[model samples]
Target: MAEWLIEEGIGESRAILVEDGAIVEAAIELPGALRPGAVLAARLAAILIPGRRGIARFEDGSEALVEPLRGTLAEGAAIRAEIVREPIPEPGRPKPAKCIVTEAPLRPAPTLRERIGKSSIHPPVGPDRFEEAGWSELLEEAASGEIAFPGGALRMSLTPAMTLFDVDGALPPAELAIAGARACARAIRRFSIGGSIGIDLPTVPSKAARQAAAEAIDALLPQPFERTAVNGFGFLQIVRRRERASIPELVQWDQAGAAARALLRRAERAPGAGPRTISAAPPVISVLGRNPEWLEELGRRIGAQVRLRPDPALAIAAGDVQSAHS
Candidate 1:
């Protein structure tokens, strides 16, 4: 049995390296603010980055390969000490991933609905500093085919003239753009998204193509939508009204990693506890870029307990949620 650490609401997890299938011998080292998961990640999973990797001691005492944890893993509650399998070695070193092992107990934070539940909203007007730091495991889940949430299902299409979203619910469509060349006068309302969002739509060849898609999106826009732009890389440009302390885009995260010195002590500790439970969630890990299933497997290996929640839906800000009510 091992310890598994999972992030709240997001689709990522992490594991710790255990000696002889035991975690007490694991040790972790991290750099930065001491979040709930800092110490364990450093010691147990030896999570250097996020991806599907494994570290197990062989019967002959040889170190095994790494496969990071990935995907949206949720359960009614944490399961401790259930026998699980170890993965085979990768043909080669694939790109690494992160395992963001974080979870703020529900007692302190806002309810999942309060955090993201929105019924409808207007589109955003302009761009704001939209940055968030997430573990590579999160990205992997988004990029991979085994993703529990579909990309199209999670993202919205925003035009400066209109905000476009399709919820399989009662609300109608919405729009904000007006034929181009104008900034929105006020902030567009936050649509009812579950949480972090990603988008994919038709490709636009020229400015005309941009507006054409906008027009089509606009025609369906009966309620109120926001604005969006596309980047040179063909990535959709989403114009979401910024949130307070959002997930931190363009962010960087990694497991604090283990000091070679720490290895000497790992042998003396308990199973899954990572040689030491410096903190409740000792092992701290993070993921960046794109990956899928990097977090789930990590949780299974180390046996960290996690309480999964639905992804954050689009939360209407105080003003918008209020205005939306009005």
Candidate 2:
């Protein structure tokens, strides 16, 4: 049976689905996750290029796009809207969550926890299994560029438009392609990778060989996906629904943001109510310095002052929390 391991961390919630002793699905819910099916009372913010894209401002100062809704919306006019899609995190930008004008607006926005409870997946119960399976190590591996399979390896690259995978190893062309396809599918599902994906396999000479490779891919990837057959150039494209940003996108491009978040999470779990100091790389410290709300929350939660120290030589992802002596 597949088991759910949900951890409510400081600034985020993480879920891992373990099946057959392996993590198959992993999801991270950040603070900004806006659940689908949520209705809100919003005001029209702008009508840029009217009839195509208009922006709405929610009560909490969050904004969503009102597009192709069939009528002119005067700027700053009040409107009721429902979120058809959840807000996805983009690097250093607001989530472009899609909303449609609704006659009935939900009073309170549904939170991530509430949505997870209502998901097809059952509510989490019993002891945690995340640390038992060394999930942190797995997370590190997923963020890395190169991932290894049995005989070959896959190099994953994240592009602005799509994610790319290059398959290369010592195995034969057909065998290597099959193995790579299976591995790629597994990686895609495990990391919750979405959007356009292109896999470059070793050039196969015959049509039958390419067909076989495509079959292997089809057999592995789950439903609700569209894929193109392997072309003569040994390239295949697969498109998956992009509900939210991929794990790599959340971690790789924003190391400083991750570091700042890590500092806050660590502080939340720190021992005692004493003042604490966080030491991290200069960039990480700068991120925290710029955002005093994080520290203010930490102070409110622990009832103590928090200090940040910059270590010029520390790695961007590394951080240490220490208690003040006095």
Best by TM-score: 2
| C-alpha RMSD of each candidate structure in angstroms | 22.4, 4.0
Off by over 4 Å in 2: 33-35, 85-95, 107-113, 117-128, 263-277, 289-307, 322-326
Q: Model 1 misses residue 71 by how many Å?
A: 50
The residue-by-residue lDDT of candidate 2 on 1-326, one tens digit each, is: 87666666656677777888788877876765255666788899888767777888887888888866646668888898877766655556636888888788465555555655633332223333564665666667556868889989999888877889999999999889888888888889878898899999989998888888888878877889999999998999999987677777777777787667766766766665578999999999988888787788778877899988899888987789987753
Off by over 4 Å in 1: 1-109, 116-138, 141-208, 215-225, 228-238, 245-326
Superposition-based RMSD of candidate 1 using all C-alpha atoms, in angstroms: 22.4
Local accuracy of candidate 1 as per-residue lDDT tens digits, 193-238: 1122333433335665555544553453333445455433223333
lDDT of 1 at 294: 30
Whose lDDT is greatest here?
Answer: 2
What's each prediction's clash count?
95, 0
